[model samples]
Each structure stands twice: as structure tokens, then as C-alpha cells.
Target: MKEIDFSKLIVTLVQPLVQEPSAITVTERDTERYREYVLDVAATDVGRVIGRQGHVASALRTVVEGARNKHINAKKIRLVINDHRH
Candidate 1:
């Protein structure tokens, strides 16, 4: 399998979300092998990205996991949504 850099993968995946006009910020955290992403966006855009019952978030996690599996010492990926309140 091809090698991948976790940090770079994260930045690439999250960059688009922050580009949206209603998006506030994207924060990322890496701990050991796991990575956590928090996206702050306006309420309207939140539904657009998150999808019904979180299908979009699930898909994002799936993609991240696929990338993580190609790397060493990586296991978990998480995405959290904040309604631009903080």
C-alpha cells in the first residue's frame, strides 16, 4: 500500500469546508495515531455538509479511515460540527 501523511491528508480534506462563505473555522487535533476535526459553520451550511442523520460526516470519516489504514500507527478519525457559536 502507498504511504500517506496523516497531517497532509487532514489539511486537504478540511480545506474546502473552511472556504465556504459561512464557514467560520476548521480546527484539527492529532493525538498519537488518532485525529479529530472540528468544523464551525453557519447553521444553514451545517445541514448541507452534515447531511440527514450525519451521512455526510460518515462518508468523510470513511475516507479518512481509508487514508489512515495506509499509514503506520494510525487508527481513528473523528469529525465534529460546531454551529459557529464558538
Candidate 2:
């Protein structure tokens, strides 16, 4: 399996989330073998992206894992969705 850089992979996925009117912020915590991704998006957009019952988030996680598995040894990857609605 080819090794991948988790940090760069995260940035690539997160960059597009911020393009919409709603603000999207991503923070990453990196360790020797794992990385975590925290994604904060406007509440309105959250539904649009995450879908009903979190299917969207689950799909995204799958994609991330597939990509990561191809190259790097990742212990875990987390996606935290922050709602920005009042």
C-alpha cells in the first residue's frame, strides 16, 4: 500500500467546504500515526451536506478512509460538525 500524508489529504477535502456563503472551518490534530478533522459549518449547510440521519457524514468518512488506506497508516479519522445556527 502506498503511504499518504494525512494533513494534506485533510486540507484538500476541507478547502471546498469553505466556498459557500456559510462559513466552514477545519482544524486538524495530528499525531505520529493518526489525524483528526474538525469541520465547522453553518447549521443550514450542515443539513445540506450531512443529509438526513448522518448518511452524508458516513459517506464522507468512508471516502476518507478509502483514500487514507491506500497510502498511510491512520489510527483514526474524526469529523466534528459544528452547527452555526442561532
* TM-score for candidate 1, residues paired by index: 0.59
Candidate 1 wrongly placed segments (more than 4 Å): 1-24, 31-33, 73-75, 83-86
Model 2: per-residue Cα lDDT over 42-83, one tens digit each: 665777666689887787777777776633553766666666
lDDT of 1 by residue, 1-86 (tens): 76666445645665565436534556778778667767666665776567689887677667867766635535476766675444
Clashing pairs in 2: 2-71, 3-71, 4-71
What are the runs in model 2 whose C-alpha is more than 4 Å off? 1-22, 31-34
Give the lowest summed-lDDT range of ten residues in model 1: 17-26
For all candidates, what are the clash counts? Answer: 0, 3
Candidate 1 C-alpha error for residue 28, in Å = 1.4
lDDT for 59 (candidate 1): 79
Worst 10 residues of 2 by lDDT: 14-23
- For each candidate, C-alpha RMSD in Å? 4.0, 3.9
